[model samples]
Target chain A: MKEYLKRIYAMLIYLFLYAPILILIVFSFNASKSRGVWSGFTLHWYSELLKDRQILSALYNTILIAVLSALIATLIGTAAAIGIHNMKKLKKKVIMNLTYLPVVSPDIVTGLSLMILFVFVKLQLGFLSLLLAHITFNIPYVILSVLPKLKQLDKHLYEAALDLGATPLEAYRKVILPEIMPGVVTGMLLAFTLSLDDFVISFFTTGSGVSTLSITVYSMARRGINPKINAISTILFVTVLLLLIIVNIRMSGNHNKKER
Target chain B: MKSKWLSFPYLVWMLIFIFIPLLLVLYFSLTIRTPDGLVFSFDNFRRFFEPIYLKVFLRSVYLALISTVICLALGYPMAMILAGNNFKRKNVMVFLFVVPMWMNFLLRTYAWMTLLERQGLLNTFLTFLGLPPLNLLYTQEAVVLGMVYNFLPFMVLPIYSVLRKIDRQLIEAAADLGADQMTIFRRVIFPLSLPGVMSGITMVFMPAVTTFVISRLLGGGQFTLIGNLIEQQFLFVGDWHFGSAISMVMMVIILLSMGVLSRYDKEHEGGGLW
Candidate 1:
C-alpha cells in the first residue's frame, strides 16, 4: 500500500511536469484551425511556420542579437577569466564575486537599471543598447563557465611553449586556447541561447525598430491568444530540441574522446 | 606596470559600466523627480510606504514564498527519486528536466495560456467530459503555477546534486536497525539535503519576486507584482524616481532574505548561503 501510494505520487508529479509540453508537441500537428481538440494530424503548422514573416523576421533579429552579444561577451569574458585566473596577488576572489553580481542579480533590476541609464544618457534606444546590455550580463555567464576550466589547466604546457621561445600570445593561441576551447564553446552556446530566448531584459532594452523572437511571442500571445503563436512555439520547440540533441551528442563524443 | 596595462581595459570597462551605473541608481533613488529636473527628497521612498504600494510589495513576497514552498515540496521527492533510483533512463530524465528550461519562457507561458484560457484546451476537454469549464488564466493561481513550472528545475538540480553526494550506507544502516521508512527519511535524508533545499529556495524566491514577464503575461496585467510595478513606473508612467524607490525596496527585501537564509544556513550547516 505504501509503495502504491509513493508510485502514484511520483506519477502525478511526472505528469504535472510533462503534460503541458506533451500536449503542445502533439497539437502542433492538429489539422483544424481549432487548438481546442485534437484533430487529424498534419504538417500544416510546420509549413505555415516556414512562411511566417513575423516569426522569421523575429528569428533573424534574435539570431543577429545573440550572435553579436555572444561574440562580444565571449571575448571580454574569456579575457577577464584568463586575466583573473593568472592574477596571483590582490583580492582576485573579491573581483570574481563582483563579476558574478550581474549573474545573481535579478533580471528585473538589471533591465530597469539599464532602461533608466539609457534614458539618462540620451542614447538612442535600439540594437546598440540591447547589444550592450546582453554583453554586460552575458560576460558573467561566460566567466562562470570558463573560469573553472582555466584554473584547472595544465600550466606546464604554457611554460614549455615559452621555454621553446614562443611569445605569450603564441603560447595562448596554441596551448591555452585549444585546452579551454570546450568551455569557450559551451559558454558561447549558453550565451547565445540565453540572449535568444530572453524576454524580460530584452523587452525593456529593445527599442522600436528591434523585436526579438521572445518579444514578438510576448506581443502576439498578449493580443488575444493566436494559433500562429502556437505554430511559432512548435517551431521553436523543434529547433531547440534539435540543437540540444546535437550538443548532447557532441559533448558526449568529446567526453569519450577525452577518456581515450 | 605590465600587469596594470593588461588589467587597465577591464578596470575601465567595469568602472564605466558597473560601478558608475550602480552609483547613479543609488543617487537617483534618494532624489525626487520634479518638472524642473530633480530635487533631493525622500518623497519617492515615502510614497513606497503607501498602503497600495505596500500591499503590492507584500503580495509579491507572498507569491514568491508560496512558489518556493511548492517547488520544494514537489522537487524534493522528484530529486530523491532521481538520485536514489537505479534507472536506465536517468540521463534522459535529467535532460528532460533541464532542456525545457532553455526553451523561451515567453513561449512556455504562452503555451500555458493556450492550455488554460476559457475557450482553450482545458475548457474544451472539460466540456467534452460533461463538466463545467473552469477558467484558470489571469489568476493568482496561474501566476504561481507559471513560476513553479519555470523554477522547478532550478530547485530539482541543486537538490539532486546534493542528494547524489549523500552516502547510501547510512540509510541502509538505519533500515537495518529497524527504523521505518518515514523515520529514516526524516532523520537521515531530510537533514542531509537541507543545504540544497536552502539554496534552491534562494534561487527560486529571488527570481519569483522580481519576475515581471511571468506575472505580466500569465496574470494578464490584472495583478501587479513588485516587478510589474517597477516596470510600469519606468516604461509606462516614465517615473524613474518612484521606480527606483520600488526597485530599492525590492533590493532590500532580497538582501534581507539572503541575510536570513545565510544566518539560518550558518546555524545549520556551518557555511553561509553562497
Candidate 2:
C-alpha cells in the first residue's frame, strides 16, 4: 500500500510537470484559433508558421546569436580556465569570484546593469549589444565547466611532451587539448543551450528591430490569443527535446568510456 | 602550464563588461545629475524606501518565499522516491523532469495562462464533471502556481543528486542499530540532504523573487513585483537613478541570503549552472 501511494504521488508530480506541455502540443494542431476550445485537427498552424516573417526572423536571430556566442565563449573561457588554474591562490580566488558575479547575481540585475553600461558608453543596442551580453553571460558557464577538467588532467604529461623535444604549442595541442576536449565540448553545448533559452537578459539588451524567439513569444503572448505562437512553440519544443537527447547520449557515452 | 597571460583577454573582458557595468550601477544608484554636473546623493535609495515601493519589495519576497516552500514540500519527496532503490528507470525519470525545463520558459508559463483562464481547459473539464468553475487565472494563487511549475525542477534536481550519493552502508547501519524508519530518516537522511536543500532553496527563491514574467502573465499586469517595478522604471518610465537603486537593493538582498545559504552548503556539491 505504501509503495503504491508513492508511485501515485510520483505520477501526479510528473503530470503537473507535463500536462501543460502536452496541452500545448495538442492545441497547436487544433483548427480553431481559440486555445480553450478544440476544433477538428489540422496542420494549418504549422503551415502558417513557416510563412510568419517576424517569427522566422526571430528564429534566425536566436540561432545566429547562440552559435556565435557559444563558440567565442568556449574559446576564451577554455584559455582563461587554464590560466586561472595556474595562478597564485589569491589572484585566482579574486578572478573566480568575479567570474561568479554574473552567475550568482539575479538576471534582472545583470541585464539592467549591462543595459546601463551600454547606454553610458553610447553603444548601439541591437545585434552587437545582444551578442555581447550573451557572450558575457556565457563565458562564466564555460569556465566553470572547463576548470574541472583542467584540474583532472595529468600534470606531468605536458612536461613529458616538452622534454621529448616537442615545442610548447605542439605539446599543448598534442597533450592538453585532447585531454580537456570533453570539458570544452560540454561547456560549448551548455553555452549554446543557455544562449538559446535566455529570455530576461535578451529582453533587456536588445533594441528595436532585433529580437530573439523568446522575446517574440513574450510579445505575442502579451498581445493575446495567437495560434501562430503555439505552432512555433511546438517546433521549438521538439527541436530542444531532440538536442537534449543527443547531448544526453553523448555525455553518457563519455562516462562509459571513462569507466572502462 | 604557468602561462597566466592566456587569461589576459578574459580579464580585460571582465573588467570592461562585468566589473565596470556593476560599478556603473552603483554609481547611478548613488548620484543625481545637477545642471552643472553629477553629484553623489542618497535620494534614489531614499525614494525606494517610500511605502509604495517598499510594499512591492515585501510582496516579492513574500510570494517568492511561499513558492520556494511549496517547491521544497513537493520536490523533497519526489527526489527521495527517485533516489530510492526500489525505483527503476531513474535516469528516464530524471530526464523527464529536465525536458520541460529545456522548453522555452516563456511558452511554458504561457501554457498555464491558457489552462487557468476562466473558460479554459481546466474549467471546461470541471464543468464536464458537474463541478463549479474556479476563478483561478489572474490571481495571486495563479502567480504562485506558475512560479512553482517553473522552478520545481530546480529544487528536485539538486536534492536528487544529493540523495543518490548517500551511502547505503549508513542507512543499513542505522537499521542495525534498531532505529525505526522515521528515526533513521530524521536522524540520518534529512541532515545529509540539507546541503542540496539549501542550494535548491537559493536557486528557486532567487529566480522567483526576481521574476516579472510569471507575475505579469498570471498575476495580471495590475500586479507589480519588485522585478516588474524595476522593469517599468527602466523600459517605460525612463528613470535610471531609481531603477539602479532598486537593482542595487535587490543585489544586496540576494548576495546576503546566498552568503547565509552557503554556510549550509560547505561542500559546494551541485553548484554547476545545470
Candidate 3:
C-alpha cells in the first residue's frame, strides 16, 4: 500500500511538472491559433516560426553571444584557474571569494549593478554591454569547473615538460592545457548553455534594439498569446533536451572509462 | 607554467567588470544627485523605508516563505521517495526533476500563462466538469503557484542528494533497535537531511524572493514584488540610486538568511543547484 501511494505521488508530481510543457507542445501542432480549440493538426505555426525574421535574428544574437562569451570566458578562466592554483593561500581565498560573488548574488543585483556601471562608463546598453555582462557572470562557473581539475592535476607534470627544454609557454600548452582539457570543455559548454538561456541580465542590459531569443519570447509573452511563441519554445525545448542527453551520455561514458 | 602573471588579465577584467560595478552601485546608493553634482546622503535608503516599498518587500518575503514551505512539504517526501526507495529508473527520475529547470525558465513561466489564462487548460477542464471558471491568473495564489513551480526542483534536488548520502548502516542499526519506519526516518533520516533542507530553503527562498518575471506575467501589472521594484528603478523609472539601495537591502536579506542557514548546517555539502 505504501509503495502504491509513493508511485501515485511520483506520477502526480511528474504530471504537474510536464503538463504545461506538454500542453504547449500539443497546442503548437493545433491548426487553430487560439489555445482553447484544436482544429486538427498542422505545421502552420512551425513554418511561420521558420519565416519569422525577428525570432530568427533573436536566435542569431543568442547563439552569437553564447558562443563568444563561452569562448572568451574559457580562455580567461582556464588561465585564472592555473594562476590561482599557484597562488598563496590568502590571495587564492580572496580571488575565489570574489569569484563566488556573482554566483551567489541574485540576478537582479548583478543586472542592475552592471547597468549602472555601463551608464557610468558611458557604454551603450547593447551588444558590447550584453557581452560584458555574460563574460562577467560566466567566468566564475568556468573557474569553479577548472579549479577542481587543476587540483587533481599531477604537480610535477609541468616541471617535467619544462625539463625537456620546452619554454614556459610551450610547457603550459603541451602539458597543462591537455591535462585540464576536460574541465575547459565542460566550462565552455556550461557557459554557452547559461548564456543562451539567460533572460534577466539580458533584459536589463540590452538596449531598445537588442534581443536574444529569451528576450523576444518575453516580449511576445507579455504582448499576449501568440501561437508562434508556442512553436518557437517547443523547438528550443527539444534542442536543450537533445543537448542534455548528448552530454549525459558522454558523461556516463567518461565515468565508465575512468572506472576501467 | 602556473605563473601568477597569467592571472593579471583576469584580475583586471574582474576589477573593471564585477568588483568596480558593485562599488559603483554602493556609491550610487549612498549618495544623491544634487545641484553640486553627487552629494553623499542616505536619502535612497530612507526612501526604501517608506510604507509602499516596505509592503512590497514584505509581500516578496511572505510569498517566498509560503513558496518555500510548500516546496518543503511537497519536496521532502519526494526526496525521501527518490533516496529511500529502489527503482529501475532512479537516476532517470532524478534527472527528470532537473530537466524542467534546464528548460528556459522564461518559457516555463510563460507556459503557465497559457494554463492559467481564462480559457486555458485548467478552466477548460473545470468547465467541462461543470465548475465555475475561476479567476486564477493575475492573483497572489497564481504568484505563489508559479514560485513553487519554478523553484520546486531547487528544493528537491538538494534534499534528495543529501538524503541519498545518509549512511545505510545507521538506518539498519535503527531497525535492529526496533525503530519503525517513521521513527527511523524522524530520528535518523530527517536529522541527517537537515543540511540539504537548509541549502534547499536557501536556494528556493533566494530565487522566489528575487523573481520579477513570474509576478509580472502571472501576478499581472498591479502585483509589484521587490524584483519588479528594482527593475522599474533601473529600466523604467531611471532611478539608479533608489534601485541600488533596494539591491543592497536584497543582498543583505539573502546573505543574512544564508549565514543563519549555514550556521545551522555544520558540514556544508555541495549545494544541488550546481
Candidate 4:
C-alpha cells in the first residue's frame, strides 16, 4: 500500500509538471487559433511558422550566439581553470570568488551591470555585445566544471611526461588535456544550453534590430494569444527533447565505461 | 606543469567584463550625473527605501518564500520516493524531472498562462466536471504557481542527489537498534539530508525572488517584482541610478542569504542545476 501510494504521488507530480507542455504540443495541431477550444487537427500553425521572418531570424541569432559563446568560453575557461589550479591559495581564492559572482548573483543584476558596462564603454548594443555577454556569463560555468576535473588529475603525470624529454607544452598537451576533456565538454554543453535559453540578459544587451527566440516569444506571448508561438514552442520542445536523449544516452554510456 | 600564464586571457576578460561592470554598477548606485559633473550621493538608495518600492520588494520576498516552501513540500516527497532503493528506473524518473527544466523557461511559464487564464484548459475541464470556474489567472496565486512550477526541479534534483548518496546502513543500524520507522527517519535520515535541503532552498528562493517573467505573464502585468523594477529602470524608465541602487541592494540580500545558507551546507556536493 505504501509503495502504491508513492507511485500514485509520483504520477500526479509528473502530470503537474508535464501537463502545461502537453497542452502546448496538442494545441499546436489545433485548427482553431483559440487556446480554449480545439476545433480540429491541422498543421496550419506549423506551416505558418515556416514563413515567420522575425522568428526565423531570432532562431538564427540564438543558435549562432550559443555556438560561438560556448566555444570561446570553453577555450578561455579551460585555460583559466588550469592556471587557477596552479595558483597560490590566496590568489586562487580571490579569482574563484570572482568567478562565483555571476553564478550566485541574480540574473537581473548581471544583465543590468553588463548593460551599464556596455553603455559606459560606448560599445554598440548589437550582436557583438550580446555575444560578449553570453561569453562572459558562460566562462564561469566552464571554469567551475573544468576545475573539478583538474583537481582529480594525477599530478605526477605531467611531470612524468616532462621527465621523458617532452617540452612543457607537449607534456600538457599529451597528458593534462585528455584528462580534463570530460569537464571541458560538460562546460561547453552547459554554456551552449544556457546561451540558447537566455532571455533577460539578451533582452538588455541586444539593441533594437537584434533579438533571440526567447525574446521573440516573450514579446509575442505578452501581446496575447498567437498559435504561431505554439508551433514554435512545439518545435523547440522536440528539438531539446531529442538533444537531451542523445546526450543522456552518451553520458550513461561513458559512465559505464568509467566503471569498467 | 605550473604554467600560470595560460589564465591571463581569462583574467583580462574578467577584468574588462565582470569586475569593471560590477564597479560601474556600484558607481552608478552611489553617484548622480549633473550638468557640471558627477556627484556622489545616497539619494538613489534613499529613494528605494520609499514605501512604494519597499512594498514591491516585500511582495517579491513574500511570493518567493511561499513558492520555495511549496516546492520544498511537494519536491521532498518526490525526491524521497525517487531516492528509495525499492524504486525501479530511478534514472528515467530523474531524467523526466530534468527534461522540462531544459526547455525554454518562457514557454514553460507561458504554458501556465494558457491553463490558468479564463476560458483556458483548466477552467474548461472544471466546467465539464460541473465545478465552478476558478478565478485563478491574473492573481498572486497564479504567479506563485508559475514560480513553483519553474523552480520545483531545482529543489528536487539537489535533494534527490543527496538522498541517493545517503548510506542505507545507517538507517538499517537504527532499525536494528529498535528505532521505529518514523524515529529512524527523524534521527538518521533528516539530519543527513539537511545540506541538500539548505542548498535547495537557496537555489529555489534565489530565482523565485528575482523572476520578472513568471509574474508578468501570470499576474497580467499588474504585479511588479524586484526583477521587473530593475528591468523597467534600464529598459523603459531610463533610470540607471535608481536601477543600479536596486540591483546593488538585491545583490547584497542574495549574497547574505547564500552566506547564511552555506553555513548549514557543510559538504558542498555540487548543488547547481546539473
DockQ of each: 0.51, 0.78, 0.77, 0.77
Q: How does each model score on lDDT? A: 0.81, 0.91, 0.89, 0.90
Best by TM-score: 3
Could you tally the backbone clashes for each prediction? 0, 0, 0, 0
lDDT of 3 at B95: 90
Give the per-residue lDDT digits (tens) of candidate 4, residues A24-130: 99998999866888899999998887788988899999999999999999999999999999999999999999899888888888887888999898898999999
Q: In candidate 1, what are the lDDT values of residues A128-185, reduced to their tens digit? A: 8888888877877888888877767886878888899998888888988998888888
Cα displacement (angstroms), candidate 2, residue A3, comes to: 1.1
Clashing pairs in 3: none
- Candidate 2 per-residue lDDT, tens place, B214-254, comes to 99989888779999999999999998888999999999999
Model 4, residue B3: displacement in angstroms? 1.6
RMSD of each: 2.6, 2.6, 2.4, 2.8
- CA shift at A60, candidate 1, in angstroms? 1.3
Which lDDT value does model 3 have at A115? 87
Interface CA root-mean-square deviation for model 1: 2.5
Model 4 per-residue lDDT at B35: 91
Writing each residue's lDDT as its tens digit, candidate 3 over B156-273 gives 9999998888879999999999999999988988888889998999999999999999999898867899999998988789888899999999999888998888767755444432
The sequence of per-residue lDDT tens digits that candidate 4 reaches over residues B1-274 is: 5689989999999999888999999999999878988899999999998999999999999999999999999999999998997767877788898999999889999888888877888898898999999998889999999999999999999999989998888888999999999998899888888888988999999999999999888998889999889888989999899999999998899999898887666444444323
**TM-score: model 3 vs. ground truth:** 0.97
